[model samples]
Target: MNTKRLSNQGGESQHQMTARFTNKVVLVTGGGSGIGRSTALAFAREGATVVAAGRREEPLAETVKLIEARGGQGSAIVADVTRGDDVVRLVETVVARHGGLHIAFNNAGVLGTPQRIGDVDEATWSEVIAINLTGVWLSMKHEIAHMSRNGGGAIINMASIFGVHKSAPMYGAYAATKAAVSALTRTAAREYIAQGIRINAVSPGPIEAPMSLRPGETEAQRAERYRETVPLGRIGLAEEVAAAVLWLASPESSFIVGHDLVIDGGVTI
Candidate 1:
């Protein structure tokens, strides 16, 4: 059991030691910022040669820089998760660069503008579904293909507590995609577990990430709202979410399969 904390932000990340993922090849999508960035750095700290992917190259580069600053090895790749060809190439590139992809965190996602189902625009709905639901599927498609052929691997997809246990009025579209992600994760886990591919999801709520803040809402306001809304009296940290991802990707969770771990600070309870 690896007990090393892998949080990558605030003041606590200065300490480092490699454990569960040493010499492993890990891939993180949406790794340009927030949970993705934190998770990528955490994996690197564990001795995994991480590949951070996002649509933007600049953020990806910065994530790599942070990993290097921590004496960890990582690289950045700009690839949109919504495109199948790009996903295929992303997996190929990781395998070609680091030998093989042993772990993958499909954390890329988008939250369209909040609107009632009757008032939401079609384009917004489509984009959210494309990036959130379809994107995860595409990533797993290529990732499982490579991992199954080479050896067993672990996957962690990003979902939301809203999608799994509750529903919000303006967040219907976003929640739908996340619910689909949870369903897809369970189905895929069953399909590929026999082949040594373990699949799971992390469904978080009101984390310290861009997606948690409402439009025009400041961090202070969001914090206060979390106090009132969440049973834990606070929002979750991106590093906290990252730690969950790292655990799911590690052998520590070898017996856990098809489980959508909720890290929502009791929001569902």
Candidate 2:
């Protein structure tokens, strides 16, 4: 008989467990800034090689710098998620370099011109739908194909709190697209769970990010409104949302499938 005793130092064991992602390959869209950026860095810190993709090269490069600064492997790829061809090439490049794609954070998004349903034009509506909803579908389409080739993988779509519940007035398009994302996530999860792929979504509330606030709105106005609406009495940080995404991507969430993990500061309640 063979016997082994557990280590007495829990801290060391915790560090070892947290490094569970060592050598895994992860691809993050919109990884240049905000929640995506934080998630990318968090994955790298846990020992995964990161592929950060985005429209701008500068922010992507900055993310790579942070990853490298922490002694993790990282590379940047510039691509627009709204284009099918771009998404295809993005996955292809990751496979070419990393051999396989194990995890993906489909986080790229845009807040299309906010206009009432009566005043919004067809072009604006189409554009918002293209990026917010279709973009996620396209990325998942290619990501699933690649991951299937390698047995299995995990995918986390960046949905919003609006995906579960609607916000009235001018947010018609944004809310609709996010709700579509939730439906899409469930569909993908059902279709692929048998094939070893796990798909889930992280719906965040009004998080504090550059993209969350309008350009002309003053901080005071935004803060006052957010405080009133959020039960936590404050807006959420990008890192807080990133933590939820990390859980979805890890093995710890193996039993969770097709679920929208809401991180809304109790606003929905």
Predicted model with the maximum TM-score: 1
- The residue-level lDDT of candidate 2 at 41 comes to 80
**Which 10-residue span in candidate 1 carries the lowest summed lDDT?**
1-10
**Counting only residues 3 or more apart in sequence or on different chains, how many pairs clash (N, Cα, C under 3 Å) in candidate 1?**
0
Spell out the clash pairs found in candidate 2. Answer: none
Quick one: RMSD of model 1? 3.1
C-alpha TM-score for every candidate: 0.95, 0.90
Model 2 per-residue lDDT tens digits across residues 236-265: 777778789989999999999999988888
Q: Can you tell me which runs of candidate 1 are displaced by over 4 Å?
A: 1-14
* lDDT for model 2: 0.86
Residue-level lDDT tens digits of model 1 in 1-269 = 11123322534544375766888999999999999998998898888899999999999999999899888899998999999999989999999888999999999998888789999888899999999999999999999999899878999999988787788779889999999999999999999999999999999887988888888999889889998988888778888899899999887888999999999889888
**Candidate 2 local Cα displacement, residue 5, angstroms:** 38
Give each model's whole-structure lDDT.
Answer: 0.89, 0.86
Listed per model in order, the count of residue pairs whose N, CA or C atoms clash below 3 Å is 0, 0
